[model samples]
Target: MASPAAPQPGATDPTLIRNFCIIAHIDHGKSTLADRMLQHTGVVDDRAMRAQYLDRMDIERERGITIKSQAVRVPFTKQNGDDAGTTYILNLIDTPGHVDFTYEVSRSLAACEGAILLVDAAQGIEAQTLANLYLALEADLHVIPVLNKIDLPSAQPDKFAEELAHLVGCEPEDVLRVSAKTGEGVEAVLDAVVEQVDPPVGVADTSARAMIFDSVYDTYRGVVTYVRVVDGHLSHRDKIKMMSTGAVHEMLEVGVISPEPKKADRIGVGEVGYLITGVKEVRQSRVGDTVTSANKPATDPLGGYRHPNPMVFAGLYPMDGDDYPTLREALDKLQLNDAALQYEPETSGALGFGFRCGFLGLLHMEIVRERLEREFNLDLISTTPNVVYRVDMEDGSEHVVTNPSEYPTGKIAAVHEPVVRATVLTPTDYIGPVMDLCQTRRGTLLGMDYLSSDRVEIRYTLPLAEIVFDFFDALKSRTKGYASLDYEATGEQSADLVKVDILLQGDPVDAFSAIVHRDNAYSYGVALAQKLKELIPRQQFEVPIQAAIGARVIARETIRAIRKDVLAKCYGGDISRKRKLLEKQKEGKKRMKMVGRVEVPQEAFVAALSTGDSGGEKAKK
Candidate 1:
């Protein structure tokens, strides 16, 4: 990368202000680079600087991933020029790279005029790098390709630069190389931002047209919406209206984030900042809504504004009935910060009252679950996560099924499940294991290409169900942590799928039911029965643990009745004494004849999802 001289900061004009985001795959040093930039700008002191400075949550730091999009404003001084002392307000929005948060990335990119396309020097480009690079290009933003982690022992900056140039249509030699860990060549990054990337640009309208990219709730001030002003200016004294929701409120504060919420009297066009709208519900102050003055509103909302929809489905049930309201409160609060989550009231005979929740993907669901338990102090259990499937009955009517319990009671129909297109980048040695894992999930190979002598990229079309359960962990294990994958929706497909139900003591256990292909139903049923046998404890009388599809039993297991110890009449080992002891034992067995309902443990549900092999390998959350 060229260490160009920093351009002179022009007048206090919005055109000189650069608003951009650092986009990359997971663990590619996006947050670390953000911290370094903050440190260089002096917004954060050397002693205050820590790993993932912009990551605000404990879960994010613990998991080493960014869950939410965060933005910060920095002051940068120019090198040698007529306007050297003038400081430019640099707005940087840090986005998550996980496939689950792709929608978040798109919204973040839509708010920026340029992006630093960061890649790990050693790992090269993974699946998400290609996914997000296309998104950035689709937005028609300036992409400055850069490589990080250049100080590692196995650093291969030249090779990754060549691959990135070939794949993303950039010059290999021009790709910047720097070690974010050591702060080497860090100033060049700032120089490139000032010289190469363009300032934020927008509409010609005089009316205020701010695009609301993200929003969250504040306990004292209500909802604070993060936005990038496209035209005109926004002020705390003005009455603002959301074009999408038509909710108007008085703006209480307008400010930029210097890693914290700092107030300003007003924010101008081509600048990124936040506004506090005294709206109670966070949904009303939505992401992608247009924020404008009520008296002088914009004619239209900005392009690419959309509501987040549910992609993955699960059931969240509270352990105690008293916690039902608490659970709803937790979800409502969580929804204030996360627009991607969707939930509705649902009831279960086995587990009592709960909610049916929807998320963007598996990781999104896991994060929500963790937050509920850790943040809210609630005891909850989530059922097996499933994808939305379209069930076409023999009558030609179709409906979507989110839960196994919601499947049709009687049907002669076809089921179409959600399918995903996955891009897997792995080393050459683990090709067989990766292929076998995908094949077992009923995936169809799309294409393959060797990026270098040691690395290859393979694409496949697989069912979303297969990918949701332990596929990522399996891929990492098989490849010794060398494989990284990302997936996108490719519509749905018809499959010979059926619902498998588990019965305890001749009664159906609704939560333990699952949807599987007809060909694998018997095998899956056997696995479920065996797993239940081990998980469910013995009762006074015999308990029949059965796996059935409707009324037909495919597999069964019997927990033998507890035998009584009788030895009072076995004295002297005589035949009459032995007969007396047997008679007493028979009497004791008659007393335990009334069979009680068997109690199934929570582990049974988890163990039932371990259907791939008979060895009972549990699925990951």
Candidate 2:
């Protein structure tokens, strides 16, 4: 990564300034409000500014969730004044509402001076809404509470406004009621933004200083750093330096994020712009770093821009070895945008060379897997997702084991695993069922509270390893998908845990293994063995499925030897059909990783399959 030249300072225009972000839950209409704001300001035509205009990614638009934080400058005018007097440059940032991307949302909020805290009229204030609202308040940003989705049939604006007032410690009249969908009261929200949200305070410093909020990599152009001018201006053709790494490079280009790149003469203080330097990779331009001129540097570097480390691990193998290079390239490209993702080469005796990938959470893992298959057009065989666990050694050493096959057998002293503080919001009617479900998953009930007349918030301390896979699905299934779950890492604690390793042909299948509590080891092993039996095809010889505790095999099963396979003589033009069938079976066999003669499907060992103990090892004669 090359360092860029410092930027020339530009004049500050306080009148043409506004900085704010829309903060809300997963589906509180934040993106929709962004679209309305763009349309109302005439920055984008009404027809062009469709719903969720800020969610440019295909995954976000399809899932109806904002994953990435986006910024767009819109021109808005006050209702009471003439066009000239009311004109303002509103820099609007659309942030992710999911808890997994809370770090991203926090970074987005730090770049802005004010936030529109959106709450759903029907749902009132959700757990995520409160979480993000507190973040904005902590940043000391002026928070403008807004009640959105008033057009819904279940709209309860009055009730939500009361809740909002109580939450924000303000009067009911202080909450702005608006329908981002129907465009009702939207103009009033805009008016409040300009009147309430303070303009950026100008700084007189001319030293090359800017804060990098977000960065992305382009194929043709190098690294593009999205920066908020904190104290000075930055222009192209000036030498710049990164305060943290001290790397320097020449500025290739600088521009704003319009439909197309609109080259800015210079981005002044409080303005947001992109710098296209020769730094071809995004890893060089980290988020939350200060950019300064090589000549005049800042005394203190900007901080709080660390990317989250992935707690979950999974195996990603290409269906064919031929696509190995392609898969590697795709992952590299994805990592350039998402710095949170981590991966390394891993090989199993059963499965060939593959990468063991890590993710921030389950959703992050799902998104990455989906992108590999959809965007890269590659076929993948993915293993079960597992949480990294701490294995205590007898020699007074500790190791974090992500893949269960790596866990030592005799060297264990005491093991500890990651736990999460989980909060589940559900209707009162479903509380009993939810509690039962949690207890079965070894959840320790911490506390409970009545959130409203019909809803209740239940808090529990659960092992992160247990909920890594199907807890969300199970909760939704029991609650009819009405429960909202939020969780954060509580800490690691000691537990009677052991790694259960599955072996095929005397070789451990890394993908089919997991860490389990000693109390539940037998049941977990039995369940996994049964899944593997169903997943693996019968071969020439019976294949043993064993789950071992140290040197002892606690549970076992066998995939029966294939007695019959190919059809005998096919006559009357049936030969081609039989040949095609054989070819298809061979292709299927190709997809499955073979340990000796037995073939295993990747889904058999998936984390979701470990939901219960009923589907355990099956014995075949």
Evaluate model 1: give its TM-score. 0.91
TM value for model 2: 0.87
Provide the clashing-pair count of each candidate structure.
0, 14
lDDT of 2 at 6: 18
lDDT of 2 by residue, 220-273 (tens): 887778888877677778778898788987777877764335687678878877
lDDT at position 310, candidate 2: 76
Clashing pairs in 1: none
Tens digit of lDDT per residue, candidate 1, span 1-76?
2122233222237767888899999878888999888888888888887889999989888788888989998877
Candidates in order, TM-scores: namely 0.91, 0.87
- What value does the lDDT take at residue 91 in candidate 2? 81
C-alpha lDDT of all candidate models, in order: 0.81, 0.77
Q: Where does candidate 2 stray beyond 4 Å?
A: 1-12, 80-84, 564-621
